[model samples]
Target: MLELSPILPIAWLLVSLGFLKMPAYKACLIGLAISGIEAISLWQMDYVLALKATLEGSVFALLPIIWVIVAAFFTYNISLHTGAITHIKQFMSSLSGDRRIQALLIAWGFGGFLEAVAGFGTAVAVPAALLIALGFEPFLAAVVCIFANTAAVAFGVVGIPVNTLAQITELPILPISMAIVWQLAPFGVLVPLLIVVTITKSLKGLQGVWLTTLISGISFGLAQFVVAKYVGPELPAIIGSIFAFLATVLSAKVSPPLRDWKFPREREAAASFAKVQA
Candidate 1:
């Protein structure tokens, strides 16, 4: 029972959040209450110490994490109110008519750029919404945005994660950045390919666009690896994102996909989209 005491609070969180469909804030508060009880009783932590730790954590959450998210949403909303979303959508659409390419551009390339600039919640939220505006199903858009965000998150917001890890471990930032790059580089490369698979639901999705995927992945992975190894963490994600975007766009010009891939539903949506434009 003592050994499993810690698990109870976690289990409660999982069940509440996943099964009960509880709102996240409520579920978190309940989990925190359970954790505090366990800590006080089983762990014999002093009440003062527990309270101090919780206070510190709350303060930390309010600063960089919460503030960053707020600023990102504010900026996004400002752009929306200013009618910039339509222009942004048009520019992305002009890049490639194929939804696969568009997904890569917005989710992988643009999301990486946002991650480099803002980190945290901005990357996924902005790009996922952009994809929806571009005609992607909401669920697919969200999933792809998450997939794309993963590649750049290690070095996100100018390598905040690596820097934080370095601070916590008392290790040199460069070495830590290098280690992270080595670990995540392959996944970065595969992320774009995975986005296509997720969007198309078929391996045949890569048939005519293998080169584009390869270029995007290799460009992003190699740039991230090299920058993290040589230039320090702050610039790797930014550089990697730029390189990947350029490589993918130029490759598309040289070797356009032999055929566009679209889900039947998306095709119907496109027909409606055309009518709206006409």
Candidate 2:
């Protein structure tokens, strides 16, 4: 029972956030408070030391994590103000008429690029918003962006996360990155297909596009694996995303899908015209 004490606060946090649906900040603060109490009572930590540690952690969070998020948002806002985002949307839409392919390109490929350049939540936020602008349902867009962002997170922002892991674990960055690739690479391949499934709600949506999915996944996973194993962490996600994007685009050119699927509302006019002709 004593061993389980450490798990209580985390359980509380999950319940608060997942079940209660409390605001994350509030839930996190409550969890922190519980952790502090446990440290003082169970671990017999000095109050002053605990306070100092908390302050240091808060400073660290502000410096890199929060700072990166703010910078990313600011950059996104700049693009919005300059109307560059509109051009980006147009270019992405031109890549493939199929929403599934677009989701793979923007969420998997483009989101990975953003993750490589700027981690935090930037990769998810920017791509999700872009999908919404392209007429994706907001909830589905968010889900797709989040899933796409996961595989690249360990190497995000030039591999900051893996570097930090190496420092904390007193291990080599290359090995840690390589290990991460082993875990994430499979998921990288699956995310594009999963996003399409999530959107279409069936495996039938994968018709005529299995090759594109296979190439995208294999290229990304192989690039990530090779880069992490040989080149080091800083360039894996960047290189992987680039390779995946290129491979996917090339595959689409070689074998375009037989049909493009659109949202029901978007297809309403075309459906009506076909009905009239019939």
Candidate 3:
């Protein structure tokens, strides 16, 4: 009796997350069921058209997503079998034992590199796996890698999003890339901040992490902005990540040590972390 928008969809989401204790995939199903019921009741006169809209979304979800998932699996399986990835970790750790640095290089740097080429779940999973193989805990690896890959997704695979948007909309790619950088810069910084917090278990790394995150984000965003603005859309993702990688590397080397490390006795959380580290 109530309007569907006013009552049902929100109910479905809440019930799924709250009552049924369902995860996201199943939550989607609950939302779909609610929508289907609404559509059938409201569109009784043109149920076919309503059904067509529903089917259209399923069709779109099926084609591109399945292809990307299948391709990522192939890359992951091969990389695992080849043992080349282990060496990649060994090479990484030899450079720095600080997990934060490793996260920046592998998850942020190398993950971004994969995004420049792969640009999907593959970019996230592959680098996440590399982080685990290199000695990070699983949750740490997963979060670090996933978040790192996302910063460049808007321009990834040689600026696919901007390129395609430009082509379809007939907008200039340069302005599009610049706008994307504005959106992406904060996300870029968030990537490093996430990794450090994931590993350090604090916002303690915040000061240095913020510094590194901004530098990397700015470098990559600027590189992509400039290149896409003047040159074209074809290489921004790869080039920008390369620039980010270099920027973070240089920052890690030059950052001053946290000369005033202390955990006040009253700060239980800080005290716990100190004990944990020791």
Candidate 4:
């Protein structure tokens, strides 16, 4: 029981957020209170030290994480106002009309790139928004984007996460980055396939585009591994995502889907048209 005391706050956070489906602010506040109580009672932490730690953490969140999110939103608004978002949607649509392919392209590939550059939920926010704009159901878009952000997260924001780990552990960044890449590379390959399955909600969804899915995954995983091994952590997500995007686009061109998969709205429209014709 004493040994497990350290994890109680985290467990409470997970339960509150995941099971209770509480608002993030409320969950975090409760979790913070729990942590403070545990520190004071279980760990015998001095009140002053606990207060200092909390202040430092709050400052860290405000300065780096919050600022990055603000900047990303600012950039997004600029892009939207300038009509760049519309052009991006058009360009992605031109790549492939299949919603499955589009999910892989936007959620996996583009989201990875955003994670590499901006991170701090920018990957999730930007990709999900693009997907919704492209006619994906909003909840599904959010879920797919969240899944797609996973593999790229280790090297996100120019490798801040890995660098921070290395700093804390007093280890060389390269070996740490390489090891992380090795571990995550397989998931990088698997996530695209998973995204497709999630979008289509059926095993049969993989039937036509399995090859393209494999191509996107393999290219992303391979490129991430190579870059992390040689070029260090900074470029893996960015370069790997670029490679995946290009590879997916080219392979899709070489072996295009026999019939482009339509979104639910498009399918409904087509059915209505058929009924009218009948």
lDDT of each: 0.84, 0.85, 0.72, 0.87
Tens-digit lDDT track of model 4 for 1-278: 67998888899888998899999999999889988998999889999999999999999888876776567567667878999878878888789989999999988899999999977677887788778777888889989999998898878689888888889999998999889988897897789889998988987898789999999988998898888888888999999899998999998899999989876779999999999999
Q: Is candidate 2 or candidate 3 better by lDDT?
A: 2
Clashes of 4: 0
Where does candidate 1 have its weakest 10-residue lDDT segment?
Answer: 68-77
Off by over 4 Å in 1: 1-15, 55-81, 160-173, 270-278
Assess every candidate by TM-score.
Answer: 0.80, 0.80, 0.70, 0.84
The model with the greatest lDDT is 4
Question: For candidate 3, which ten residues in a row score worst on lDDT?
Answer: 257-266
Q: How many residue pairs clash in each candidate?
A: 0, 0, 0, 0
Per-residue CA lDDT of model 1 for 112-137, tens digit only, reads 99989887577887787777766788
Candidate 3 Cα errors over 4 Å, as ranges: 1-25, 38-85, 207-211, 253-278
For candidate 3, the per-residue lDDT at 40 reads: 74
Using TM-score, rank the candidates from best to worst: 4, 1, 2, 3
Candidate 3 lDDT, 115-183, residue by residue in tens: 888764667767766666665666767777777777767776776766788999999777777777777
Please give the lDDT score at residue 27 for candidate 1.
92
Q: Candidate 4, overall lDDT?
A: 0.87
